[model samples]
Target: MEFYSLLFLLLPFAALSGWWMAVRNQRKAHSLIFSRYQKEYLAALKYLVDDQPDKAIQIFTGLVEVDKDTIELHEALGNLFRQRGEVEKAIQIHQNLITKAPLQSGLRSQAIFSLAEDYMRAGLFDRAEALYLELLESGVYKVPSLTALIDIYERERDWTNAINFCQQLERATDKSLKTVEAHYYCELAQEVLNREDPTEAQKYLEQSILCDPNCLRALILSSELSMQMRDYAQAINMMQLVLGRDPSLFPLVKSNLRQCYLMLNTKSAYQSYLQSLLEISFTSPILIEITFELESSEGTESASNYLTDHLRKNPTLAGLSRLIELNTKLVQPAQKNDFQILSELIGSLSKDQPAYKCHNCGFTASYLHWQCPSCKRWNSVTPAVTK
Candidate 1:
């Protein structure tokens, strides 16, 4: 649809270029030629307006042949082909433009860039990467070429190359890429950790924190490393720092924090910390976790009472779901069935809902992402609805 629209958009440009080419040759003889093309242009536009863009595209592509010397016509046709997913045809058109004798330097560079784009659209990363690097070395389209190289490297999971190109892009565009670079470092850290190289992993995690001090992924990895090494105190401290930075991360680190507290015989301290969070109205997964803690340490009645009060202050689907769950457990044998049915209904409502969503594009997912998968924006995916 976008491709056909682009063809329709180029109709006037193609017509003007065709007319100009005919006038440049011999006005008297080619006047009829220009008139024929003018009628064809109006017909193509009518086809487009009538929702017959394929017919419009065919007419326009043929009209460009009226002035083969018109580079803009060829370029527009190439772009149309590319947008239509006919990358081979796009590449051929741009390649022909590059091979034209006496081509201007600017036109040559444009053709190369266009060809590289065709390669990218065709998923021929190696071919596209080579052309982009060539363009970069030529100092033409430096920022675009560097950006393309960064995307290609990232897609290939070549973190070393990705980091290098990302830094170059940052310098060329004067844009801060520290947050994205931090994710690259975290990726490296995870790779090292998978290889049982905790020492090296820690070094990468440190670099990540240096890039973005409040990097939650780095903190999470650091805590994991400490836990693997039996350093419960250090793990707890790191998670506490995470919660301090973003209380929304409480659910992600809750189990780890609980394990650390249990390992150190500090459940009471953990409970006190949770109570402090509730005091400030940090009702979220925190409240849910606290309800479970109360159920275990106190009783069903105590947990029920606490949730009932919390719900009065700030109610949410999750809070309502938990309240229903608690009631199901507290009710008598005959009454339990009704409460259980209500609990099941509430759970079904929220079960398919995602815990995280992209703030930029509104893409929802079950797990956390440092970069929004849909928008490709760094630090844009965040916890949804505080749970």
Candidate 2:
């Protein structure tokens, strides 16, 4: 009876021991699997760091099947695929995350955004537009979605939609997009002007100025419209406003202003205006225009003297080229050939140099661009004033 009682007491203890052993073995197996997964993850990261994306992508795709909790890892892999220009793979990955994975609401939104970016990279703007529109309802992605939609509209040259979305973006961020909006209005004005509707174009320009009082592009366009209407005085007033706002744009309007002055029969007034401009900013373009005026009105000797004095004050390649050009006419026949050669060489050099440079991105162009082609910033490309 004593032996039987002891065996019965030990039975519960034996069952408890078996349960503990099974739990330990199961934990060991789970730990080994986790350890293998960690090693594979590190190896994939090594492939990415070494710029071997194809191998990294393969490893990551396999890992995703084993672990569905890697939402962040999936995002990283999608970005990597996009950067590698593998848009199809990126789309597939993010789509799978959104549809196949059991993600919460926030993770699902993130997957959708990633897929939208993939579409953008692939230039599937229509598809990307749809996805971005869907994301607009999500608070976390609202601003970015609006911004992306604006970019898409701009690319499509859909100014109406661009302006509408821009207004929404302005309200969302509470920061002024007046300058960008002004540019949008100017774009609309340009389109109407192309369609031979000056009256409609004028309305857009007015709206642009209303948005930003100091919009240089609108003023210039308005002046151009005034010139077309044969209203010289109005054109002159508008151009002067442009100069007062940004004198660097003198190169753009110099010829127009000269023509307006001539139309008004005000040569003396134009000369006076040039002199005043020179007094304020002695740019090469201003000096060159003045020289041409003096040469035509006062004579070559007077123009040569005026240019020589200014050159002494502000030496520039353009000034030097003009001086050489003027001297070529005055030089003896023997020296004329040498002066012409030097002038040609200087002209060749200046031709290769860009006339405008973007302050935002260092992008250079031969002509003025109100918006930078590279960085896409407004009013960034300005006259390149090389010393």
Candidate 3:
């Protein structure tokens, strides 16, 4: 493009020299042609310099057919089309540029990348993938092309290809791929589990942990797989490991842990654990779970007292309602209805609450998602706890 502009500036001198060569025979016609060309080109250049790309592009497009010198003008018009969301036109222009002879390597690659982007924007993932892979195999535009391929595979849920591309990415930059690799393993493990292949699922989960030991999703899945294999003890161990790593996740594992304890027939063990945990921190759901257990074994009196004691320090509607529900049957009929009403009110209030939230995107979800649906970030969504 710089070559073109430099050549343009020297066109007048070339014309002057040509006029000298032709002598006085065709001077008037040459002068008229030079004047017309110079006037339009200078006007277009002024608009281009002033950032009036619409007018500049229009004037430049009109001039492209006049000479092969307008290749840069075609590029400007293509970029303008892309900026205006006319991706088809942009693709056409860039594709045309690659076909032009004597193309510079930089221009050729730019056109290829731009064409790939246009395909991506047009929802042609296969086309985009092909171009990105071609760029990758060419051993040029490696980083950006691999990045584009990664995004394409991610969007398509082709975790295998995404994993491969990210491996290349880590090789290219030596940036850590620990978290992403872990998520990729998690995705594969989830699919394996859905296909009822526990053996392969276990392998992927182990690989996931090795890739990122801090991945809570891996822990959760590990516990789930252990439970499926009926290793309640190991399941309980995994859930506790998750809690020790991040106690704020207790709410997420608490219900699951309760189920594991039930499966192991270890109620007393869980009761002792829950009592200590509640004293360390308040949990409305654990309080409910514990009160239910207490009422089953020790009767309503102990359960009501236990719930009442916790409610005094860290009260919530759920805790208060559980306490009232436990005591309502033990109460005299006159006061029983009043406690029941309060219990019902608290139940209604808690009904509309969201159970999980994404810390990264402020997206509320009714159930936990290992990867945020809105932001597509792994482990950002967690159980919304009350403590």
Best by TM-score: 1
How would you order the candidates by lDDT, starting with the best?
A: 2, 1, 3
Model 3 lowest lDDT segment of ten: 15-24
Instruction: Give the alpha-carbon lDDT of every model.
Output: 0.80, 0.81, 0.75
Model 2: lowest-lDDT 10 consecutive positions: 1-10
Model 1, residue 324: displacement in angstroms?
A: 1.5
Alpha-carbon shift of residue 208 in model 3 (angstroms) = 1.2
Q: Cα RMSD (Å) per model?
A: 5.9, 11.7, 9.1
Predicted candidate 2 versus true structure: per-residue lDDT over 1-387, tens digit per residue: 332232233334332234334434554354333455766766665665566767866776665443333455567667667877889889877887787455556778888999999999999999999999888866659899999999999889898898999999999999899999999999999888777788999999999999998899999989988887899999999999898767778989988999999999998899889889778777888889889999999988889999999889888889999999998988899999999999999999888778999998899998899879899888899988733
- For candidate 3, the lDDT comes to 0.75
Model 3, 168-277: lDDT tens per residue?
99999999888988999998998988887899999999999898989988898888888888899999999888766666677678778989998878888998887777
Residue pairs in clash, model 1? none
Residue-level lDDT of model 1, residues 1-387, one tens digit each, is: 343343445455443345345434554454343455766766765675576756765665565333334555557767767887878777877777777513446777888899999999999999999999988888899999998898898789898888899899899989989989999999999898888789999999999999888788899989989988889999999998888878888878989999999999999888888888777646568998899899999998999899899888888889999888888887788998888888889889988888999989999999888777788777898888773
Q: What shift in Å separates residue 34 of candidate 2 from its native position after superposition? A: 10
Error of 3 at 156 (Å): 1.9
| Model 2 quality (TM-score) | 0.81
